[model samples]
Target: MISVSSISEFVYCPVKAFLNQTQKDNIQTREMIHGKLVREIRRGYEEITKQNMWSIKENIELEYIFSTIFEEVTPFIKKVSKKYSDKYEMDYSVLKDICNDLEDDLKLESQFLSLKVKKILNTTSKRGNEIAEMFFPQSLLEFPLKNEELNLRGKIDKIEVVNGVYYPVEVKTGMPPSKGVWLADALQIAAYVVLMDYELNKEVLVGFVDYIKICERRPVVVNSILHNKLFGVLDDMLTMFEKQEIPEFKLNKNKCEKCEYMDICEYYG
Candidate 1:
């Protein structure tokens, strides 16, 4: 299925996009492994946050709320640590120590959340709580789109209402506000909005690229000109996919050097 990630590859390079679409197996590297770890960690945090929100709605005490959630997540942490240890060839003792360290860090984060809850209660007035509750009410919004010809099917992260305006949000585990952010990320969100509008039959005015690592939210406002450009690229990609032709690599020396498929790429010379 074509994911928002496949859209990102198209922006990075059409040759890479073609390879990703057609290649049976793609190489993995240490960087990709580390990136996957970070993504998993961030996903865990998001899940905990969502559960915490639910607990708060249930009127559970903040201290117990955090403690309970942490307890439930410990097994998951241990499972991930064990998997990481098995995947990497490292000293067994060292791996055990690292796992212990990570466990402590998770505990510290739990304590921090407990403190945050107390602070929120102390600082927020009754009136403020009411306003905040209305603004931040729990909602699950998803945009599912499928294009059989393109072999694409995936759910966009969120379609939320903020201040009565619908916004599409795409989450990422990356640095904040790079120049490539707009050029690459905007297209994916634009595609999501387009698909969503088609499905819902309503126009969405704004979208966001949410960088979790840096806590940055980049706004993306899609207009006709930008949408047209994105559509053109998608058309080219679909054409290449249909023909089963590998596009010629436009050597991006810097990116190619870091790419996992560098060794196999015909243009490496």
Candidate 2:
């Protein structure tokens, strides 16, 4: 299966993708390790709850959300409660666990919102000094996507719903561009939109790249051009899979230096 991750590697260098699949695991770099840790933090953030400010009208107090949380969570509990019905009070415990999970998630979300506000205040744009608010009103974590016909598959880190529009949100433990997103990152988000569109039968127009460490939210708009690129890359990916031949190495010393496969690749110099 062609992973969304491979698109970025191919963007960086086709040889890197070839090496990534053909070779065994190499030592993870500091950046790689830090990235893994950051992902862990994000994954920990999985649950229901938010310190949402922008979405709700000012007249509504934040306490209203908390008061209604149980009402909102009840349907979910009832839907899944059968699994625990056999045990004594286990179903009740499950409900309690769910509530606790939501509460914890709310705390993390509060922190995240605070950080976002802080960042926006610190930034000054050409238009003038202004603060920005970027948040997901509703989000589903670790969502899976697959297109069997295309032989493509990957898990989306998040699917954020704002108003009624749905978009994928990918968290990166790396640097983001001053303008737009990295090619690989764009491809990944595009793939998510494609898979989601197929599965849901709804058009997914945009997605986000969350550079978590820097607290930057970069939006990626999926267009015909990117879709064409995705198709081209999928073809290339399949071709490489069929041939089982490592593609020619692009002579970029800096790229090689950063690649995990450098130690084992035949052309590394």
Instruction: Please name the candidate that would achieve the greatest TM-score relative to the true structure.
Output: 1
Candidate 2 lDDT tens digits, 143-260: 8888888887788888887777898999886677788888889999988888898887769888899886465789999999999988888888889878986566558998878776
lDDT of 2 at 179: 82
Predict model 2's lDDT versus the native: 0.64
The C-alpha RMSD of each candidate to the native structure, in angstroms, is 5.1, 11.0
Give a tens-digit lDDT track for model 1, residues 1-269: 55555677777776666666567255554545555555565557546554544445333466775775476566776676577668865456765665565557667766765566556656664332443344344434455776665555557776777565677788776565564365778888888777767666658867888776555678888899768977787777777777877566567888787665566667677
TM-score of each: 0.69, 0.65
Looking at model 1, the pairs that clash are none
Off by over 4 Å in 1: 1-3, 24-36, 53-75, 83-119, 125-143, 148-152, 161-165, 178-180, 246-249
Model 2, residue pairs in steric clash: none
Worst 10 residues of 2 by lDDT: 124-133
